[model samples]
Target: MSADIKAWYLSKTVWGGVLAIIASIANIAGFGISGAEQAELADGITALLAAAGGIVAVAGRLVAHRKLK
Candidate 1:
């Protein structure tokens, strides 16, 4: 695999984003998702994605800062 694809697979944040997208697709397609509990799961996944985004942003800034130093 290319370095780019390998880096993507190695990133926890990217994995979280991918999972979030998949979960949304499943919810949209109404595949085995029903009632409040399942809906709550979606909400949790969204929150998880938010957290992963924050982590990625902070890490990116750190890398940029170090590179520019």
Candidate 2:
């Protein structure tokens, strides 16, 4: 993978697959997630991950003794 490319964890496909497996498990437990609901969940999770990454980046810079070149 190139440095410019985002990680697989940030991908919609990866998140959607995770949601699918979760939905399947929920189905076995008699709970349900509709298609629209799954899409919404995936979108929300993706945004949340991006925000967390941003926070980590900012915190790392704040905590670093060496200044950016």
- Which is the leading candidate under TM-score? 2
Residues 1-69, model 2: lDDT tens digits: 587899887888899999999999999999999978998999999999999999999999999999988
Q: List the candidates' TM-scores in order.
A: 0.46, 0.89
Worst 10 residues of 1 by lDDT: 6-15
Cα displacement (angstroms), candidate 2, residue 67, comes to 1.2
RMSD over all Cα atoms, model 2: 1.7
lDDT of 1 by residue, 21-67 (tens): 76678878886434454556556766676688779988899888466
| Per-model lDDT | 0.63, 0.92
Pairs of residues clashing in candidate 2? none
Quote model 1's TM-score: 0.46
Q: Model 1: which residue pairs collide?
A: none
